[model samples]
Target: MEEYKKRIVKTIQFIDNNLDTELSLEKVAEIAAYSPFHFHRIFRMITDETVQNYITRKRIEKSAFYLALRKNLTVKDIYHQFGFSNHSAFNKTFKKYYGKSPSEFRKLAPENFHKIQNKESKNGQIDTVFDQYICNIENLLNWRNMNLKIKVTELQEMNLAAVMSLGIANVEPSYNILIDWAKTKRLFPKENVKMLSVYHDSFKVTPPDKVRIHACMLLDEPLKKQEGEVFPETIEAGKFIIGSGEVTLHDFEQCWVSLFLWMKENNYAVRKVFPFEIYHTNFKEHPEGKMLVDFCIPIH
Candidate 1:
């Protein structure tokens, strides 16, 4: 694909990974590796609708899915969950696209789900043009309901020096960069170094510019950096909730989401330490395109 097309694809994937977060144009542009003004023009020319319109449409569609499948969650909860500011705002836009109020649609959702899924506008227009979410509603809900094995353990503090990155990392370009740097420096030895990452922000909570993701190696000793900053930080000693399973790179976001949900249900409070991951093996060397990873989040 051409550069702009590649960037647009990445932007769409970013939206998928962060549907619960605020997706401003500037934030989405960062994922595409483009300036905000330039990316907006290119996106509009290529996608027709502006970026804001696209995000709003996708959110509303996902909201519809939530309304149908998540019976326990209230409409108000689903409204805010999809990032709408309030009921009035969600209702007005929802009616424009779905041609019914939120409650009206919810009441009819069970018997008329097929109709809702195939719903269209009066002028034969697409209620929302989408390449993914509309087509995969069942799979999305099923994945959310997955059961994963977890463990709670207490561990001592760890010291790490990482090459931190700021961007939408669903594809983990930052991990690639850090591994390349390690290869040049002969870091992360089989016995001497551990490959780990200290995630300083939640993809669902932190702003794109302020996210702190450190693609790091366990250091035997603190060493001076040759060029970029190497941060020395502590992974505090505490109890932790660990979600472990054989998973591919694609499963990282959902895995974390599930773990946090598990924590809430189990009544474990999140301790204010940046969560980190421990890889049983490197991704490049894994034969199945999957690896054993212990996703460790500190807890009280």
Candidate 2:
């Protein structure tokens, strides 16, 4: 079961990386080294959506992200970029999910699209409502009080053995499990091993209860076999904007928000890859109960 899940995760990562290309069931199943029929059934069982539905939904969500935040991209440019055959099809699908046409959504979503409710009035009063409620991304600068040291640097590729944790509430337990596995495998040394949590979905896009993350331990080399739910993954070498600081639990969100604001202020474009954290100190052992961490976002 663990090995099966690992394969599915690998395929999901492949799908995310190649959203602009053709992704048939056969092609995706090959990534998992599974027969298409079996892969389809397993995928539905695990992710609760058919392969095509998942692909379409992801494409729509990505398109929505661009429409809301990337003002430089026109509606036509976005639709074509996400692999839609034509504008008509893209509009129809987008409206079915978001209850608004692409242009209408673009007009309304300034900072975050998820906050936009589907309660448009008959008399264009929705514009007034949106104006009152929209959060300006510039306001995120308020988090500067956290005094995070942010920098842009190149990161080497890494190999990891990871355990999936669904929802924020389950993160600690997943990490505990991963640590125990490492102990049994003699992967830990006298010094603290590097631990990381990779975000596979955006908090702004997915519901908090349904968000997916991986609790991972950096590996010197790939593991020979899957142990329990732990499986190997690799983070590609890339340029990243990183925010490093000592933060309490309450400070995590603010740190992330500030990093994104910093990225925007410095004119950096985000790459379509997972953002992650590297833990340098365990909060439980710190005198002030603060964890030293580095939050890294891949950039184009």
Candidate 3:
């Protein structure tokens, strides 16, 4: 089962990286090293979604991210970038999922509205929305003001043993699983082991309860065999913008938001790779109960 899951995860990663291209079921099945018929059933059984559904949903979610954050890109540009054939199909599918046209969704995004307000306020408009979103943005900016250091660096490919968690609340449990697995493998004395949490979905685009996170430990060498729910994965070598700081649980979301804001301010385009955090010290053991981490965002 672990081996099967490892192949499925590889297929998912491939699909995520190649979202802009055509992703046929047979092609993805081959990635999992399974016959198309059997792969389809197994994928659905494990992921609780059909392969095509997963592909479409991911495309739509990514498109939605572009719509909300990359306001400069027109709806046509986004749809085409995500491999949609035409405006009609894209709009229809997007509306079905979001209950709004792409334009409407973008217009309704609080972050976009906040930016617009900032521009207008400079011209004496001064309108404001006293909502939770405003508070969140302010908190993010406050955290950014803490002199968070960001640097661009290249990383070599990393081998990881990971356990997948479905939501933020389950992340700790996932880490526990990895920790125990590491102990059994005698990979403890974790002072040298790199612990990371890979974000598979953007919290801004996906619901908090539905987000996917992978709790991973850097492996010195690839595992000889899979163990239960833990599986082997790799983070390909790439250039990344890393934000390093000590952050509390309450400031975690703000840290990510601030990093993206920094990326935008610096005119950096995001790569298809998932962003992740590398922990230097566990919050549970910190004097101030803060996690010392480096949030790494891949860039083009």
Candidate 4:
């Protein structure tokens, strides 16, 4: 199982690195050192998307990001950069998913985006990196005299079918809703559905009324369209520090607190991208069993 997972991770990395190049089943399978027939089955089981669909979605995601986050690049440049053959194809696909032209999205997003950033950072006083929320001494004590096993890895871009939880009092209810949604949709075969948790706000910094969390499933298929709150998201490629442990779910907050302190102590600056958790075991299936979770924290 570990060996197969390594191969899948390798293929995911390969696809991310070559998003600007040609990618095909036969080619990607060869890169994974597996026959196309075998690779297709495992790849879908592990990732939830057919090879072709994953590439298409990833290309669209990269282009949309360029449109929104980058000021210098034009739509035509983004079109070619993501390997789209022409502007027409890219526009059609972007409109289908985003329901707006690239220009439309770029304008709509920034109106609310930077304001949110400023609000998160402002502390009534002058804005500083060590805001009152992050300067707590108790959080530092959580890491003192503690031993942790950490692995720093470069993870490939991950596309998720997520259920957004905004202003939820606790993370558990959101996770329950996500798992139930997965079961109703037949998205879990143990091997196919990977239960991942994404934290978009700092509990210490963001107020409970404004916190953001996502309960997500890694895909082997394109995200199914639904009228409910489920949405699609992509975490861009980056280097991350992974910390793993088997612990009671209630103690999970400590895990992150410890890691943040560890990052500060080691002089590692946190990346703007959110931190996420990848669960290795299904805890609902085993109440007595603690979870094996990897804290995927982006770093420079």
Candidate 5:
């Protein structure tokens, strides 16, 4: 798993460095040391788009940046800058995705253009083009309807030994302790352990490190008999309105945002300290289809 993660990071670096070139699946496969046939399948499975499709989407995304920031550059100039052979092909692809010509986009969709450019700019901390492309594609494919919601009523209280984090990035090591210690303590006894990660801060404002994630479990009674370091204080009991959605891995933020908006519209006041995720689908298991995360938001 660690090796695969390292390879994925290297692939991202390679793409960022060579976006101007023709990014071929065969070449990327070689970089990842996979056969061409298998690489295409894996790429789509991991990225939720064909290699060619991902490349084209990234090109268009970069074109959006040039359109907004380098206002003096002509449409043809921006097209060729992205290594498009001709302006017409560039216009065709852009229109296909955004529903407008380059000129129309510049004129009528200035805000969208600026938003893209600003997001891609330095200090913005926007993710790679591939991530953005995957997210947009997922949103187009899966939009939620409130009526489709499934309710889970009567969730009991939980006691957790936790270390809180805020605006923090890349704290996988810290959370490992929670998992490791819980096991050593035999917290779940005969019950199958359930892993829960709760996010307490909005990603938009909080730096990645500051995002609080409480890695915890639901315990059985025999385990609860043990006290002190063996058990932490009980997690407060509350009535929670649960809403869940399965989304492409890239579209996690959209799912979270949609759920938050739903709560807001329905007048549900969520406590900041208790946000949680029940991971129903592992990322490695289904790299393409959808990742299921069930959220429990306490309602007043």
Candidate 6:
């Protein structure tokens, strides 16, 4: 495994050295001395992305620097230089990876660059490299040490498909099962569905992993539960303070500890509902598995 990892690092360095060339998995596998057939699996296991995805991501990362630094180059020239055959292909891939087109990125480049630098270092900070490292550490501590208080409100009715589970450790499995069920039922929405993680754990003394979690959705009130008759639970709606951080479900205890501490420090009361998590993005997209989830706890 160490040998395979070293080979992957070397292959990635080669790709970095020759991003302008026509690179493919077969070629990369050859560089790594691994079979082309087994290359994708190795890449996925080691990097959590397919070889093609990795290449595209690297291309986008490099292009981001160019978008800021290179003014004379047209998007077309950029695409051609990056080995993308046409502008449209380049535009599509850029949008998919960066959520913005090349032209759009170029237009916003200067302002975005300054804004990012400033916002990232509003506190007395040195360079962006150090600022980012400090921010990450601060966020991690905040996610672990912040206390949370509970409040109540009346929630508007919603239509949703969900998986209901008792213990917090079951949250991940329940969430995956609900997603799978949504896929099987063809209920996954492209643009509108506000994926939610609702919680209701009355017993305060329960261990963090043993706390309950319900992977749910807030749907239009009129739609009824059809295939799976998970309970039509009502979530009281009101102004509830929520804190979010980038952490995995397996490390959820840290977040909970933070929330409890925050609540205690602030003199806020705790509600019975288990704090729920909404996974907005898994870090599978990045080489670093920096997964981010928002923990919504009903607080006073």
Q: Rate the local accuracy (lDDT) of all candidates.
A: 0.68, 0.79, 0.79, 0.67, 0.56, 0.57
| Candidate 3: tens digits of C-alpha lDDT, residues 235-275 | 88999999998888777766777788888878888886889
Model 4 over residues 110-166: C-alpha lDDT tens digits?
322222111232434312122233325565454433534787789988878776554
Clashes of each: 0, 0, 0, 7, 9, 21
Regions of model 2 farther than 4 Å from truth:
26-38, 68-73, 108-140, 222-228, 286-289
Higher-TM-score candidate among 3 and 6? 3
Q: List the residue pairs that clash in candidate 1.
A: none
* TM-score between model 3 and native: 0.77
Write down the lDDT that model 1 would get: 0.68
TM-score of candidate 1 versus the correct structure, residues matched by position: 0.49
CA-RMSD of model 6: 20.6
Each candidate's TM vs. the true structure? 0.49, 0.78, 0.77, 0.50, 0.45, 0.42
Tell me, by TM-score, which candidate is best.
2
lDDT of 1 by residue, 1-300 (tens): 245654675576578558789898899999988899998998887656688977886677667766754577899899888898899999999887766788987887644443333334587753422223332545533564553468998987676666555445432765665666667778735563577877754543233443456777766665553233344545768899988878888887667766766676687766647788887776777887887788898877
- lDDT of residue 38 for candidate 6: 87
**lDDT, candidate 5, residue 189?**
35
The C-alpha stretches of model 5 lying farther than 4 A from their native spots are 1-142, 146-152, 166-168, 187-191, 221-234, 271-273, 285-291
| Native-to-model Cα distance after best TM-score fit, residue 299 in candidate 2, in Å | 2.5
| Residue 41 displacement in candidate 1 (angstroms) | 23
Which portions of model 4 show Cα errors greater than 4 Å? 1-147, 168-170, 222-227, 285-289
Residue 74 in candidate 5 has what lDDT? 93
